[model samples]
Target: MSGQGPMRVLAAMSGGVDSAVAAARLRDAGHDVTGVHLALSAKPATMREGARGCCSVEDSRDARRCADVLDIPFYVWDLAARFREDVVEPFVAEYAAGRTPNPCLRCNEKIKFSAVLERARALGFDAVGTGHYARLSGSATGPTRPVLRRAADPDKDQSYVLGVLRPDQLDGALFPLGDTPKAEVRAEAAARGLVVAEKPDSHDICFIPSGDTRGFLAERIDEAPGEMVDPSGAVVGHHRGVHDFTVGQRHGLGIRRPAPDGRPRYVLGLEPVSRTVRVGPVEDLDVTTLSGADPVWLVDPPSGPLDCVVQVRAHGGTAGATVRVTADGVDVALAEPLRGVAPGQAAVFYRPDGGGDVVLGSATIAATA
Candidate 1:
């Protein structure tokens, strides 16, 4: 919190409890703060018109109210044009290619850190802060400085989704609620009389309000009905589309061949080119190693082999792995076999010291072995 002047800070408020509380904290800390609500896309009529959630018109008003209570200026910036070109389009395209894309990661990378952050800088703001549950630290020397750490409340830590943040972005970023638990943050909001204090956490992607991603994709992408085949290439059933399924998925496969021992068959692979969904027993799904491409380093890249834990997805648990910073990307061989490593998911590396600092950056899941 040092080396910062009495400067302007733009706080990205998502009309959620955490972000509202973050804006209040920045105001209390004596910095000139402004609340910015990013309008992601057009409002859907079925969305109950005034729901104070992200991407909804109601949410923008809630953000304005929080700014009002904190006595800070508030504005709504339309980034839908860039959002479609950057996050939404890429998401649809990736899924069409049979990859399970992480749109939240894309939103953070292209929108929050790149577009919105740039806008803040252009407005003469010193830094842009958000309610993200991550911490940043380093000497305040240059733009390319700082290390990203997990929030104090491990249960609420969001560092995994933020591994894409560059060192320069981290230097100008602040997470006011990083050290506060969700319950405490809510309590502070209520004590301060904020309306969204009791609002539920926004979980689903903002654009797809109904959480029916398969349906959304069906409307957007041309469908090629595929066949469900066993590993031996025997046809089991028909699938609507291979893009709707992922590795280790069991429930929705429509194929009802009972297991010899009364177990359930899980999807083991997706062959997009062959237009087949490969199903097998659970043991066949175990993956002992994963290769990722285009890895970015948060701290300086490690010179040699380093031991750390890796998380393959946002909420996935950590697995023990030996991490080597390769010229192409990070190579991680899991000490224990992991199941369900899907392409296009994030694989984030964490320090073993439990400081919760993200040592390396995010990578696209490339191959599973």
Candidate 2:
């Protein structure tokens, strides 16, 4: 994607202002750009109005209209079948196994980068560009070895979700809007006369457009009611399903009694087999060590302990930590305890480089202590 000469770029547009601006930027940069809107939903009529995020039927039309204004070829690729098999099913399975899964990250990994990029390359496209708020750096040679970096706007930085990408995916990826702030992008969209300039950013999971995640999961998986117990295994309350809870959750636990110390009880663990929701003081949620599986490295895999920043969630769960590469996975020693580190969530490691903390790599959390 780091070619100075014009290159054939497949721009993944989700009918959002960010994507529209991204495609326009690429086109202005003189690349042969084609806009593609991925159809992830089998039944678009059932989705929310105006395609919030990337799953709605209206999203395709919006993307088409943007392409028309930019005077570029546009196509809607139906990836619903693959989306269901790769992203949706795994999401449900993770929750069923008593863990929280970030489907947005999964979509970026399985669909946008994997499926879309593969198809684009088969059709002779050089790279795939998106509106993701991340930067790409490269060498001076013709075969630009692109390296992923953080965006200028920290609030809208999406490097965490894109952390699952490998070095090859990095070479095939382009983030045109990375250096630009989001406000400037919106302004550029309006100036360009794009239709989606003012479209509100989609925050909810695209599949669960209604934003009722628990309700959605309940419909997919059978309810296995269970006991809510204290750290000592004393039954404090009852839960309808262990899948309805997650580590560090303090609300909607359905626990009626206050703790002996009069503090709100937080969920510490979920045992899906026993359907047990273990609750205790908030302090119990804090842990210093975490093990992550199936690591994907952006840089050379470390042979020994490495110091970096650790982020457990999409936003705000961050700590300075030391990472040790293991035979099966990675062992992290947090400089300070982080609360609610749960299995199935990606532990994205970053170097403390002032340039947006370069994304070192990521691994799925397998266990925590």
Query: Model-by-model lDDT, in order?
Result: 0.81, 0.89
List the lowest-lDDT window of 10 residues for candidate 2.
45-54
Clashing pairs in 1: none
TM-score per candidate, chains pooled: 0.94, 0.96
Regions of candidate 1 where Cα sits further than 4 Å from its true position: 1-3, 44-53, 139-144, 355-357
How do the residues 1-369 of candidate 2 rate in per-residue lDDT, one tens digit apiece? 465678889999998999999999999999999999999888875345544445676778889999999999999999999999999999999999999899989998899889999999999998899999998887323565557777889999898999988888777888999999999999999999999888888988888877778999999999898899998889999988878988999889888898999999999999999989999999999999999999999888999898999899988799999999998889999999999988999999999667437899999999999
- Best candidate, TM-score-wise? 2
lDDT of 1 by residue, 280-327 (tens): 889998888888887877767778887887888777657888877777
Residue 125's lDDT in candidate 2: 91
What is the overall TM-score of model 2 with all chains considered together?
0.96
Per lDDT, the best of the predicted structures is 2
Would you give me the overall lDDT of model 1? 0.81
Candidate 2 lDDT:
0.89
Q: Which 10 consecutive residues of model 1 have the lowest summed lDDT? A: 44-53
